[model samples]
Target: MNREPNAQLIAVMDEAQVSNKGLAKRLRDAAEQRGMNLGTSHVGVQRWRDGAGIKPETAALMAEVLSTKLNRRITPSDLGFFSQLTPATPPAPPSVGYPSTVSDALSALNGLAEEPPKGPDAGRLIVPDAELSSAVLSWMISRPDGVQADQPASQRVGMRDVHAIRAAAETFMQLDFKFGGGHGHKALRYYFRYEVLPLLNATFSEQVGTALFGAASEISQLLAWSAYDSGNHRLAHQYLTSTLRLSQVTDDRMFGARILSNLSHQANYLGNHAQAINLARAAIEGAKGKATPRAMSMYSAMEARALSNIGDHKGAGRAMNEAERYFERAESSSDPEWLSYFDSAELMGEFCHCFRDLKQRRESVQYAQRAVDDTDPRYVRTLGFCRMVLAQSQLLNGEVEAAVATAGLAVEGGESLQSSRFQRYVTDFQAEVSAYASNPAAAAFNEQVRDALARLDDE
Candidate 1:
């Protein structure tokens, strides 16, 4: 079919300062980075520039490549290809690609804030395996660029501003723990995008700049966690990758390692157990002497969780033992404030998960009780999850009445939060209790859970 030349595509390529061959190479690498293989070359890029139609997925990838390269949001429509998409072709998912630099990361963050990706996994670039692995490896060996903010933007900043950002992050974090991600996700994004992101470009002393980037990393990780809890895995991963980029600029190895552990946790949740284990191990390796005992313990616990999920019981147990040992050595004073949430209650919760997955009913019950009993009242979501695990363990041991009572409590507690993860936990528990549907207690517990979930959906 004859078509008009894509003048818009040519203009953007020129604006991005990339030749046709360079754009082709970048598109190829972008696909490869995400565990996808694309055979496009300069010829194809030229064809697109000449108004040849492109596939929806390729169009999305091309937009992402130009977006990061130019450090701004770019869509296929910006390249004059909107009408080329036929009715049978689904609209391409938006681009949330891995960023190549700190500036690119900031731009990507702004894009996410202005328009959060819709649906379950719409804008994800990195899959659990190759792309994720590549991102983690790049973060590990990366060196910091010294004396950041030497060339500042128009605004001036100081340590006071940095502290304010940190304070706001702490407040948002507490809200997330108490009321779930849905309560604070939008507000947190607005705060970070408007209140904090601009500071990254402002003039400050090296000391203040380091503190500012560190604070930004913390908030970014919190954003990732909030997104994960809200069932927006694509947004979560993008936030985390951006967090890693920010942490690198601060030259804070331990903080970056913590971010890696967060990625590992999410990877496990998304069913990429092997990748999760690798990421946890990468965190440990990268942190080395930089991580305090508590941080080390948390990474090991993440590894144990993944191992258990993959049926590597012996490996999981060894990792769990190591986690406990390192945790025993932890000093409260030496631990970073960002890691304060991983106390004994949290460790016991990890143990409960590992044991539960391993089908050790007795051990799971013991740890689950400790996790639930020791959790602070402020940690409502954590408490509900611990109770759910305890209930599941009790059912496994044939304590039907006790299990039903505990599950009912879990359902009641879960009603107060807006976390999809918590709802999933409740659903999983209900599925387990289905075999005992003939039992009156189990039947009532299932009904209670269904009602609770229905209420959540309405809200």
Candidate 2:
């Protein structure tokens, strides 16, 4: 069969200044790096360029190589591998109408329950900055209304049901903090789909309805966080949006602000620095009077993170100062039960992140030390993340030995946790430490990380 020449592949290969021979070599090298042995040559590259069909797995591997070389995400479709792209771009999520009212919010949540899983393999579905901004604006301008049973279903719900949900949500949150989001993720989803969704439709008084919605919102927000941690961005977005709608119905402005803060954190993680900044600011603005100082401090710290990410040193400094001031004013007694986790240790971790991004290695290391030292041992994921930050800071400070030691601890701490985000941190540190692999200690650490990651992949 005659095939069309792969102009797109040829163009990108040229842009990367890679000859067919070079690409073939790099492909083999990349596969070797992944512990896979794939044979390839200039002949294979020529065939691909001539539009001969490529295996989807090989195309995905090629996309990964190009993405790493270009320092940006390059899907297989971008390289004219349309067959490989099919799995990445799934069908659109089910629509349940716009979330303008409490009923509408419930509809959205129900639709989300039926939506197909966009697991790790599916490419991210990014919300544009304009759309994100518009959502924030809508949430800000919207006023909460009293909730009541519009049309009750067979099941009866009350304060007991709400309490049960809150209890279950706390358990899942604890599991998430310790074992990472993938742990208990399926149980949480099952609970939401089977147990939680029915309560939303059950008969309840106005007061019970209000509290029930609040519980629903909390669980949905937790779902969003779990999805984000698992690298399922599309599902996370849906759960977050639905949470915001439910929060509106529950009249919990502060809770809504926290959801926005979650969005900021996700945006920053995805490299949408500008949008992250905007989302953080919106959280601060939207919860002005309702938010406790602890909550405000967390929001401001998120802003600082985004600012530092965008290289706005002065802006980040100001935001950091604001965050510190808010923390100083924060009293645990006055804060909500949910915001309890944003303690001093977490705050220090935030500072560590911002300072690291700003290249303030000394400050970053100091804050990271405090964060790691003060964090509870049970919060394994937090420890893993903070240790990675400390490792990066130490490496930048020219303390190669110390950096290697710290990164080794991070890898060990991450062993029990099943978070892809945490793995990415380890992966990044591996890349950074590769420069020092000539050092005996750094070489050992590199091998350790490689083994750990390989084990993860096998499981």
Candidate 3:
């Protein structure tokens, strides 16, 4: 522990564009994904940077995630880590990679949230495939977390505290809808760590506790989406897993299904085709007879995406039909606030992406147009995604000029939106259209995308 700065580590991180804290988080996430209970924070990273050695195993894990990201083989030595920084610890217990108790869940959350001892924890993140499925399966069938009530009230908490939390969550939701997830995650994480966590561990009645879990789950859901939109997939997975456990503990089946549907969405994006399918089905089955029409519709919509990814065209069509049918049955008054986003425009957006994957350009354009036309202006990010789908559909139809025009609109709208995935759509569009670069229209579109993205990155 000479505490001498490890210049080699600094050079590697600088080259990789990873902050010290981001590297710290990626390691803990990698360990958790592999079902290890070990944790690492920015402080350890600071120590390593200060000439402290890293555990060989931790260094290897760090190399793994980083290597995979950079599309190359990385070694512990490449990261300037110590030849050995492993801690002496008990062996990892045999279990799926997910928390089984409040303490475990909290530990997982803290691992995700903690930063390098000296710097802000920041980065684009993602959910790992094994971890997503493992967490989803456990929440579906696992025993209760046995969160006990406070025998003697340690702190006086009333409906006022509960209401305050709910209101804060709603405000964050509105901010996310109006601006983008990036605009809210930092604030959301801060609130969760300070305002909310203390109350979670404080004393309360059964009614209060029930309300608290539900409220907290909703807020956590917001954080999950915020992370996803921000391009932190593994971190998003962590949040979803934590929230799903809380939903089950609260016996909030409806919310549980919602969490699963969100997981499916992320899974499909990450190409975890089978996991996406299973998660969607689990949502439907776990919430059977309990999910509102809107909720079920969203779940089916996710299944459609999974099916499309796996080349199950027929299954995708059936799932799409099921989603439409469920939407038709949804009642406004009976729907929860969370499910309200799954409206007509949202359903059409789902259809747009499904048909795009199925190579049915006409249908894709049809639904995409509808989604773009109908989605509320308040939901800026959703609208941006729909436009990207429409742009892609236009390309599939050989309408390059129209596609570029639509894509321009998406980029314009995207400026006000704060989502890394949304930016991904921009890049995906560029790559897809670039293949047609021989076409004059396509060449022009390429220039537009190059310019648009430069501006977006500057933001």
| Candidate 2 lDDT by residue in tens digits, 238-332 | 77887887788767889998998998898787666778999999999998999899999999999999998766789999999999999999998
Number of the top TM-score candidate: 2
lDDT of each: 0.80, 0.80, 0.74
Please, what are the lDDT tens digits per residue for candidate 3 over residues 1-459?
A: 245466556766776788878988887887777566556888887777777765445665676666555543344544554423211221222133667777676666555555312211122123445665677778778776544676565685667898899899889998997677778888888888778766878887778888887787888889888887776665677688777878877778899999888888876775556778988999999988988888888999999988875557789999999998998998999987666677899899988888887767689899999999999988888899999999988977878889988988888877767776786677666655654445687667667766776776687
> Runs in model 3 with CA error above 4 Å?
1-96, 116-134, 145-147, 438-444, 457-459
Q: Name the TM-score of candidate 3.
A: 0.74
Query: Model 1: runs farther than 4 Å from truth?
Result: 1-98, 122-128, 150-152, 457-459
Sort by TM-score, top down from the best: 2, 1, 3
Query: What's the TM-score of each model vs. the native?
Result: 0.77, 0.79, 0.74
Stretches > 4 Å off in candidate 2: 1-98, 121-125, 149-153, 457-459
Q: Report the Cα lDDT for residue 197, model 2.
A: 81
Give every collision pair in model 1.
none
Model 1, residue 406: C-alpha shift (Å):
0.7
Best by the lDDT measure = 1
